[model samples]
Target: MTLKAYRTHFYKELEAFYPQEEYETFFKVLAQEYLKLAAYEIPLNFQLELDEAQRNLFDKALSRLQQNEPLQYIVASTEFYGFPFQLSPAVLIPRPETEELVDWIYTDFKNTSCTILDIGTGSGAIAVSLAKLLPEAKVTAIDVSEDALKIAEANASSNAVNVQFIKQDILDCQALDRSYDVIVSNPPYVRDLEKVEIKANVLNYEPHLALFVEDQNALIFYKKIAELAIQALQPNGILYFEINQYLSVETVGLLKNIGFSQVELRDDFAGKPRMIKAQH
Candidate 1:
């Protein structure tokens, strides 16, 4: 098939299941991945061989796409903080807000030899990115799931950075017998009640353990991480969070109640108050 023909067919099929905007972009992304997988042969750009083997691969990708699986998850990799990261169902796909969180932290401590811990460090994006940017700093990442840690390790290797990866649930994290100069997280803050607002791509494909909190206590992870920082941080150590768009005030309040001073909240590219920074 020609590239034009393939484009039309892919867009039509994708639009049958997803929004027009998403379908259009995903179709282009699909073609790009297919081309890359095929080694980008000049004449065969975006056109599968149509033989059994190529057909099978194409069918599998299309099936997952139709099922609303995120393309990043299907490919098992994503880009964050200008670095490529390996991913899996074990890890939450990186988001732009998380990138912004990393950038803010990187800039805030660019000249310091600080110890940093990224709690709930899915895919190790935040930890590895920080390690790469601040090679002199000590960066440690913690997650409850071993499977997620495996992917995070792979990502750290791919990024060519060293990070301490620990397997521990945030709620039950043991004392590491040390204090950090900065603690950061983009923990699960989405409440079950907000499921209606989540797109099918996210609700169906992303790991819920990294995305959700109980409606009765949507701030659970934020509270727990804040409490930990109160003791785990060195005096004047910083705590940062990428929070739910609707919970800016509540997140700031939680930080203040934990005795974090100079608490500041900032907006994302969309102007939603999505990040909070506080000092212990």
Candidate 2:
């Protein structure tokens, strides 16, 4: 079939599942990812015919899109901190706010060769980005799921950045056996009560273990990581978190209460307070 026909049908099938602009964007991405056709190239190749293999791949992706499966997962890749990362259901697709968090860290220590630890490092987006940007920095990342650690390992290798990947539950772990000059976590902070505010694409497709916590104790991961950092952080070390926008006050308060000096909450580009930094 002609490329135009495929595009038409792809939109028709997902029209109800996404907005008009979104469905169009999805088609453009599909064309680029599966056929190597740029968005503008789609017009130049409007009458181009799809061979059996290309058609089969596009058909399967279209079917998955109709079910509301995230296109990133269907493609099995995503970009973080301006770099491509392989992804799986075991990891949360990296987000722009998280990129902002990474930016803050990279900017702060861009010239230093500090030991950095990323707690609950799912896809290793932050850790691997740091390693690449600061080749001198020692980076270590941890995750509870072996599946996530596998993806993280792949990302580190593909990014050509060396990062130590460890499997351990932060809530249960006692010691990292060494101190870090930088400790960061973008751990589970979404509360059960806030589910309604989340998009269906995230709620349905992303791993809940990495996305949420109990409503009564939404800060569980942050608190536990902070307590551990208090003991594990080298003197004057920095602790950073990608926090829930609504819980910025509580997150800052927790860090301050832990005696982290110069605790600061920063807003994302959208002006939401989505990141915080504290010095131990």
Candidate 3:
């Protein structure tokens, strides 16, 4: 079998689940991952293995993809902010909007010694990125799931950044003693009613606990984190969030209601109101 033949068959198989343009990229990425799994001994020009064992692995992965699982989940890793992070079902994959949030914080505090805290620190993407960018700042990250924290710790190590990973729910975070100069979160904000708008890849592969909120209480985590921020931040501290685009006004309102001044909402690359920042 030649590489061309393998790619042709792969694209045909994926066409049932994806469009041609997406099939092209997905096929290439899957081929790359497969080559890496084989220790790169299999060159890109060669065909993928059709042996029983390798075929089984490919079939399993393709089956999951057909179910609309994210390719990152299938690979169990993703790249964010030029750093590779290990991912699992225990944590939601990091998103580009959250990358903007990190970049915003990094630009504001990269040269400062301000302390930072990241709530709901799934995959430790934000916390680790901050620590890498601002080595002088102390970074602390908190999450409710120990499994997620384990992946986050590994990601912190992989990024060669020191971040304190705490396994405690933000909703139950009461005994914390430290105050941060800047606090950030990309908490669950998807309202139950907005399920139809979500992509099948996200809905199928990503952890729901990290993606959704009650329909009537879509701002649950934001409200809780803002209330906690009142006591967790130093005077005149800043709070940042990757917010749902539909709830930009509500998110800003929540920050104002919490007494955070200088509230600002910014759009992401897609021009959706995706991030909010405010001062306490």
Candidate 4:
């Protein structure tokens, strides 16, 4: 079928499942990946015909999209912090707010050769980006899932950055083996009740272990990580977290109550309380 005709069919198939602008983006991304057609070129070559294999691929992607699969997972890749990362159902797709967390750390410790630990580092987005941005810093990332650790390790290698990948469950650990100058985590802060607010694409396709917590203890990961950071951080070391917006005050209070100083909560680009940094 001609690319233009297929594009129309694609929109019609997915129009109910996704926004017009979003499905439009999906087509552009799939076109580039599957057809080697740039967005600009897609318009100019509307008459171009897709081969059997290409049509098959697009059909499969359409089916997946209709099933609420994320386009990144469909493409098996995403961009984070200006670097390309391979994606899978094993790990959570990196979000832009996490990039803000990385930038905050880089801006603070850009010149220092510090030791950093990233707890619950699903795809190693924060750890790898920090290692790349602050080359002199030593970065270590830990996750409970072997599959996630494998993907995170590959991301570190592919990004050309050195990050130690360790398999550890932060909730089960009592103490860290060593101290770090900076410790950060974008842990599972979404509570069970908040599932209603999540989109079908995320709720259906993303890894649940990396995205949720019990409503009774939504700050479970943050509390444990903060406790570990208190004893595992060097004197005056900083701790960072990507927190849930609805629980910002509670998060900051927990950090302070746990003895963290200079506790500051910051909003993401959308002005939602999504990040926090504290000092030991």
Candidate 5:
């Protein structure tokens, strides 16, 4: 079938399930990946004919999209902080706000040598990016999920950066094995009460273990990490987190109560209070 004909059929089938713009985007992404055609070129290639393999790929992708699987998962990859990362149901897809968190750290420590740890480093997005950006810095990342760690380690290797990956459940640790010049995490901060606000793609496909906390104990990870950071950070070392926007005030207070000094909350580009940094 011709590209234009399939594009029309694709839209017609998914128009009820997704926004017009999004289905168009899905087409564009598939075109790039399966057709090896740029978005600009797609318009010029309406008459292009699809081979059997291309047709089957697009057909299967459309079926998955209808079920609300994330496009990144369908593609099995995503771009984080300008670096490509592999993704799966085992890891939470990296978000733009987390990119901001990485940028904030990079801006502060790009010129210096340091030790860094990324707690719950799903996909190793932050750890790998930092290692690539600050070649002088030593980066280590830990997660409790072995499957997630496998993806994270592959990301580090593919990105050609050296990062140490460890399987660790931070909440059970009595103390960190070694001190770090900087500690960062984008831990489970979504309260159970907030699940109603999550989209189906996220709620259904992403790893909940990396995404949720009980409403009654929403600050569990923050408190535990802060307690460990108190002992694990070098003097004046920094800690950063991609935080739950609604709990910014409580998160800041938690750090201060735990003896972390100079706690600062920062917003993402959308002006949500989505990140925090503190010093020990």
Candidate 6:
């Protein structure tokens, strides 16, 4: 069938389940990433015939989308920090709040050579990006899940940056062994009760191990990581976290109670205070 005809069919099929723009954009991304053709260019080649393999691929993507799979996982790729990353069900896809957290670090320490560590570094998004931006800095990332570590390691290599990957559960570890100039974590902060607020795609497909915590113990990772940071961080070392939007004040308080001076909470582009930066 022609490209135009296929586009019409694919969009109409998914528009019932998703918004019009969402499905339409999916077609455009499929064309651009898989076909090397832009959405605008599709009309120019409206009469171009799709090969059997290409048609089958489009059908499969549409089928998966209908099943509520995330488009990023369907495409198996995403862009973050101006670079491409591979995604799977094993890792949570990087979000804009985390992007802002990374940029905040770059803004402050772009030129200085320092030791940096990423806790719960699923997919190595933060660690690899920092290593790329601050090439002179020492970068290390850790995850409790070995599967996550493998993906994180691959991402570091694919992004053409070097990072040390280790499998360590922060909740059980008392010390990080060495000091760090800066430590950042985007650990499991979502409360179990907040699952209702999450979208269907994420609740159904993303790894719960990387997204959730017991509501009563929601700040467990932050508290534990902060304690470790107090010991692991060098004098004047900073601790950063991408925290839950609902608990910004409480998170700041925890850091302050733990004796983290210069504690500051910042909002994401959406204006919710979701990122925290503290110092030892």
In terms of lDDT, the best-performing candidate is 5
**Candidates' RMSD to native:** 2.4, 1.3, 2.4, 1.1, 1.0, 1.2
TM-score list, all predictions? 0.91, 0.96, 0.92, 0.97, 0.98, 0.97
Off by over 4 Å in 6: 38-41
- Candidate 1 structure, TM-score to reference: 0.91
Better of 1 and 6 by TM-score: 6
Of models 5 and 6, which has the larger TM-score?
Answer: 5
Q: Model 1, range 1-280, lDDT digits (tens) per residue?
A: 5565656777777777878888776655555565553334534554544555544565688789988888888777778978999888878888898899999998999978999999999899999999999998999999988999999999889888889999888887646457899999989999999999999989887889999999999998888888888888887789999999898998888889888878999999999999999985
Worst lDDT run of 10 residues, candidate 3, spans 35-44
Which stretches of candidate 2 lie above 4 Å from their native place? none
Give the per-residue lDDT digits (tens) of candidate 5, residues 1-280.
9999999999999999999999999999999889988879998999989999999999999999999999999999999999999999999999988889999999999899999999999899999999999999999999999999999999999999999999989999999999999999999999999999999999999999999999999999999999999899998799999999999999999999999879999999999999999995
- Runs in model 5 lying further than 4 Å from the true structure: none
Candidate 2 has an lDDT of 0.91
Model 6 agreement with the true structure over 1-280: per-residue lDDT tens digits: 9988998899789878998878878888988877888667866987989999999899999899999999999998888988788888899999978999999999999899999999999989999999999999999999998988888888888998989999998899978889999999999999999999999999999999999999889999999999999888998889999999999999999999998978999999999999999985
Candidate 3 deviant stretches above 4 angstroms: 37-44, 47-52
lDDT of 2 at 103: 90
lDDT of each: 0.84, 0.91, 0.85, 0.93, 0.95, 0.91
After superposition on all CA atoms, how large is the RMSD of candidate 6? 1.2
Cα shift from native, residue 57, model 4 (Å): 0.3
Which residue pairs in candidate 3 have backbone atoms (N, alpha carbon, C) closer than 3 angstroms, thus clashing?
none
lDDT of 4 at 35: 86
Could you give candidate 4's per-residue lDDT for residues 28-132 as a string of tens digits? 999999988777888998899889999999999999999999999999999999988988999999999999999999999998899999999888889999999
